[model samples]
Target: MYAILGEDKSDVATLKVILKRLIGDDSIKIKTKGYNGCAELLRKGAKQITAFSKLGLAIFVVCYDSDGKDPAKRYSDVVSKIIKPTGLKNTICVVIPVQELEAWILADIQSVTNVFSSWKPKEINNPESIDNPKEYLEKLSRDCNRRPRYNHATHNEKIAPYLDLDKLKCKCPSFLPLVTLAENHDAHVAK
Candidate 1:
């Protein structure tokens, strides 16, 4: 079983969609715990570790938009204060700063906009004026591909400029374990 702790319901839904696509809905159990912010999620995640450990479950914590803070420091804090003390390694934490679970979905921007309709910015008031942030982003992505130099910024740059890319880069390696684990689990069931 896998449990995902996120900043909000939307983040959890996005993660659930990805997890279902990658590992199959039946093979993994997904649950959402809301937190005011990354720090709070870390706090709750610590407690979750104990309960999950008892159930012999694997837990994955994914947080977004860490507000320019060092993800490694945050992760280490959780591990040292919560996970390690509990002696749990089956649990893995992956943080995606600036946008949470939305970053992982393979869908184009428009798809994302549809999922987060309520949160769409009113600045794009014109019904046809790139009203959907996701759609706007998808267009930008397509344009970037057409003109390579137009890639002055990466996807994260366009969607979430506030993120500390340096910190995100440092913690990205942590996600490999979960990705590999999910892939392996999928392969086993397929066979």
Candidate 2:
């Protein structure tokens, strides 16, 4: 079981599902509440770790967009806040994608092309370099088939599925941590 803490629900809807697959649990892994925002997530985390951690929970995965901040710095800052309250080191993994979650979406050229015909994925070799990924996504979404009114409520989920995990993991340095977390989670479950 696990808890998904993120800056917002839109940021992690697909991620939680992908992570479950990534974790490689042999049997169905029951998770605590599906997902919660970081502020609320932090409070929930503080509660579960202190009061209910023994309830088959193995890890707390925190996902946050860098939003112009340094990914490493953002990751460390978040870790400092949660570690003392949760007393979890290995069990708490922070996923900070540079620029924003959209950066990861753009990392996979195939996925980007699947959604938008106008985007040149090969040109986006470094997603982190883009100043405003969300804007680019919106523009590209308009260029998608029939300009299908792209918004977080409608299209965010569509992006992750098309995203090639191998490509995303290899191209985005920030995304590698997510893969590492999955590997570690699998090891812990194996034990």
Candidate 3:
């Protein structure tokens, strides 16, 4: 069994799709837990990790948005503040999405188009580089005159199933941890 932890419901909701696609199996028993937000995740993450570890969860995929902070530094913080203290660093994958979780959605323009046909995203060569991808997505939805402009909480999970995993991995560097975790799990299962 594997568990995923994210800053909010939307993140874990979207990740459930992504990780299932990566693993290519519906019976793997992937569970998700979400915190209120980044601050809450940071403050309470360690305890959650420790508790989950004690429960014998095989792996934990923890996600936090960088929120325009340095991705590497945020990754280090999650490692130090959450995983390291649990002494289960090997069982945890820390994914710090650059700027926000929406960046991963923006990485696949086709996915956005699949969700909203009217949404014509301006060429986003590097999604992770966008200053505020969540706001940018909302602007795109609004400019296209879509009813109920892109909301992170709703649209992220909506678009995730349509996302091209290859495109996301190529465009969003910080997304690697989740991919690595999936790959490692696959290897372990194969053996």
Candidate 4:
């Protein structure tokens, strides 16, 4: 079994879809848990990892948003604060989405348009560089006069399943960790 941890419900929800797509195996059981937010995740992650490990879940995928902070700092913090302390660094995959998880959402404009046909979002050249990607998406939805605007908590899950994994991997460098994790896990399972 594998496990996934993230800062919020939206992150967990969206990540679940992304992982399933990348792994291409619905039969693979993936357990997931979401903390309140970044602060809560950071404060409680180590304990959670230990609990999941005890439960026999070997591989862990932890998702954290950079939230305008340096991506390297975010990655290091997860490694130091969670993985290292738990002595499970090798089994843990840390995915720090630059700025916010919304950046990945923006990586595939076609997916967004497919979900919200009325809002034709412009292709973002550097989605990872956006300081507040969620706000950018919300503003774009409002600007296009799309009804029921973009709410990360709901729309993220909806758009995620349809996203082109190739596009996301190419556009968001931080997203590669999850791809690698999925690939490694798939190979292990195949063996």
Best by TM-score: 4
Q: Candidate 1's residue-wise lDDT over 44-134, tens digit each?
A: 6667657765775665655544333565675566666656766766646565442233332222233323333332322221211223334
| Candidate 3 lDDT | 0.81
Q: Please, what is the TM-score per model? A: 0.54, 0.78, 0.91, 0.93
lDDT of 1: 0.48
Ranking by lDDT: 4, 3, 2, 1
Which candidate would rank higher by lDDT, 1 or 4? 4
lDDT of 4 by residue, 1-191 (tens): 78889999889888988898888887778888899998899888888889988998788889998888788999999988988889764478899998999999878866887788877766777888777989988888888788878888889999988888888889999999999988887565664
Clashing pairs in 2: none
lDDT of 2 by residue, 110-183 (tens): 56556555544454677778877878877665765445555664566666666777767777888777788788
Worst 10 residues of 1 by lDDT: 121-130
* Model 1, runs deviating above 4 Å: 62-64, 98-107, 113-178, 186-191
lDDT of 3 by residue, 103-147 (tens): 887788667777777666665678888888889888777777886
Q: Which ten residues in a row have the lowest lDDT in candidate 4?
A: 182-191
Q: Model 2 reaches what TM-score against the true structure?
A: 0.78
